[model samples]
Target: MKTKITNLQPGMIVGEDIYNLKNSLNLKKGQKLDRDMIDLILKSDITEIEIMDSNASIGFIQKTFEELPNIIDETIYNKWIDSISDLFHHFTKEEIYVSLNNITEEIYKSLNVKEYFVLNFINSFGNDSLTYHSLNTAIIVSIIAKKIEIPYIMYKQTVKFSLIHDIGYAMLDDRVINDFDSDDKNALIHNIVAYKKLQDLKATLNHEILESILYHHERYDGKGKFHLKGEKIPPLVRITQVADAYTSLTELGYTPYQALSWILKKCGFIFDPYYVGLLYEITGYYPTGTKVKLSDGSIGIVLRRNEIEFFPEVLVNNEPVKTGPDSNVYIKEVIE
Candidate 1:
């Protein structure tokens, strides 16, 4: 049955999950809600209500998930993942030649004014495609920077650097570029080439920031691109490396949980320990879209974020779970 807020009552059944007026829907969760108390809502007009069909809607969603396009397909999208990734790709490759003067003038102005951008890429769309890859890298870097609450200027420039960082890949043939090992020494050559090209354009960038894009591949264990670590590696560079890997993996097929877990598990080995800790906290352990089981044995679709990494806003039996991090009630297990 379709869930309609207006038609709902405290004790009535909506979906597989039970309806508890006190604990569910705009209040602390995990217990039954009091109908007498819920009468207070009667005073206010119900402007917007969230609801879902318990059966057909959920199964349809699950079944149709894999059939969805692997890459950004829609000209318009409101979903979080689709919008962010698309923004990253679209901005970086908007022009074949992102000159330093143009990058400085155009990107700086755009970043200064707008908090976000969009990507509508189609001509190039694979690992072999250099422009798409660069855009992907920039967007992931920007996302990490934003999550860390980087200052607007720094965040904007980080994105600009990321966009120009992989310009050298255009020199390689499609086949070779496509098949090139992401970890291969040849990756450094791309940075080197891009760096020189940027210099020719008279790139107006801080030295450290420029190196971030050029040497982001450098590993902590001396096995990576520049083989440099400690203070020698710029902070943004390290951030980009981790974000780059996460984005590429996530874009390929791994879910957000999978990508973040990989980063968390590789702490200090491939990623900076400090940043790894921060990223782990920011991204959390379980994937965002994962379905979970509550301590009370109720199942809910993971609704976006709750204050706690593990705690997420949930929709139980077609009604929203309103508990928060400090609340005694929370998700307890993966429900499959």
Candidate 2:
């Protein structure tokens, strides 16, 4: 029978392994629940457990993309969500060639469609932070790659790198992987683990793709593990770093605008200046699909951006509101 962790009895048997946010097994099947074990589960942020029974269903990780769309462009967002989910699973299973086919289709579809990039990302966010990070990173990478004029092949490869760059977390200890800081020893160790696993998998890969995944955590200012600085880091790696950091910041209680602002501020110090500029150019301060309050106390959803980062066209009560210095109305605050 399914039971809450607080309601679990001392002798109840675990029906199946329970996984953490990283998809690592936290509790093994058939383990008997005790007060101490229950205490551990509570501290781990886990809330539910299954008691063994003939009628009880085994637990499994549900796909994040299995849902109806909620954005302005539902069709395109749905395709991107499914493609990211498919690409993520393909890389997790080490099916590199198959993932290429899926990514190619995603890039091709995204070429003519320019408006849904941020909306697609926001729609794909879920409870699984790792999966959300991977998907959002991939989408943002693809968008920035196009603006930087990277060729189709390299673009596809970069998306793949973003999707599986953190796969090493699964191999590391759950305690360390959940911490979310590169200063932690386990974080750097996972980067090496992920790189070595890619090589050991025997999957055909470009040398640069492997390098990018291996060094995605490296800082542009020679501050990271290998102390590689500036041009020493691969351009794709730098791009991936910006995207990865953006996703991490957004997941850690930073609003989209706040996260972008943080990334811009860290430019040249932590991230590559050129790529950070590209991120600002792509997502802007007021990204599409977000609501903001005007100086006149009006609410609106951002529709599109212009040359000015703060000035964007917004839909206010189903009417278009132009905001900039020239107009009396300007964005006062972003609606959280």
Candidate 3:
């Protein structure tokens, strides 16, 4: 029962617990795969398959987790980064691409727009980094917007800007971005550096999108390194700036619930309370892939949840468990 998400190609047998997508839907599991299901998942935004094959049992993830605390070790960080970048490159190459077109809409039909949005972020991020800091940042923005119940399309645009937010990185060497710089000119480096590189991608970036990325680091206190702070800040720039900061935290290991708690406590100091609340609503108490312990002493991974509610579609004991007609299990604790 190997339950690690790694390289997944077609023709792979899958009967064990696994995540799948149907028209931009989030990952679901335990469903046997025929050719059509296989093709549909392949075409969706599924970046990783936690289950190896159908013959394997679902409880493998927990057994593996208890034995090996880190199924994904240090080497996994780079692998995840690469996987993310490649996913964006693959989809954005041709069309705007929609991960789940409408099935999720049916699942959460009664949920508020914000909850729907948080689901969207979890579903979207299920793919690899694709654009690293940028795409992840976009996801954070989407999450925040969902929390606040902003229109899905508006936040979706925010995500678009985020995905290509640093598309310019495509043109530069690791030295320019993945390194630290002196405070003086370094303040201006992040965006200017990225903006300059985007020029080479042949992308059709507009002023707003470019400016958002260009000024993502600026603040409203007028003390930002780039110094384009205060009212001089554009709305999108301010939005992306905080979204980027918050997303960085999640990427570093904070759960969406933990992050939302911190944001609520620190809002108005390091971040705007209005937007902070918005982001809090976007991530929900849990997002997909978050591992939790059930009251019965078994553990599961959260796969889906609305921003407003606290429960999610989780895989208990590594076996896929849905919160639908068959089960009545509730979460006990998250595997921090």
Candidate with best lDDT: 2
Give one digit per residue, the lDDT tens place, for model 2 in 147-239: 776787777777777777776664552213222233456565777886786785545666777787778777777888788899899877888
lDDT of 3 by residue, 1-336 (tens): 342233443324343443332342222333222233344456766555545443453311111123212312334334444544554455333332333222113212323443343222221122222244554465455455555555765655565566555554343322122111113233346467767645543344456666777766554555555666455766666566566655544432345555556556645444555566555444446655567887667787765564234756776655666553345666778775
Q: What is the TM-score of each candidate against the true structure?
A: 0.55, 0.68, 0.49
Q: Who wins the TM-score comparison?
A: 2
lDDT minimum window of 10 residues, candidate 1: 58-67
- Where's the lowest-lDDT run of ten residues in candidate 3? 173-182
Give all candidate RMSDs, comma-separated: 17.4, 8.4, 14.3
Regions more than 4 Å wrong, model 2: 1-96, 111-127, 173-181, 289-291, 318-320, 325-328, 333-336
Alpha-carbon lDDT of model 3: 0.47
Candidate 3 error regions (>4 Å)? 1-133, 139-157, 175-188, 196-204, 220-222, 227-232, 253-266, 319-330
Better of 1 and 2 by TM-score: 2
A best-first ranking of the candidates according to their TM-score comes to 2, 1, 3
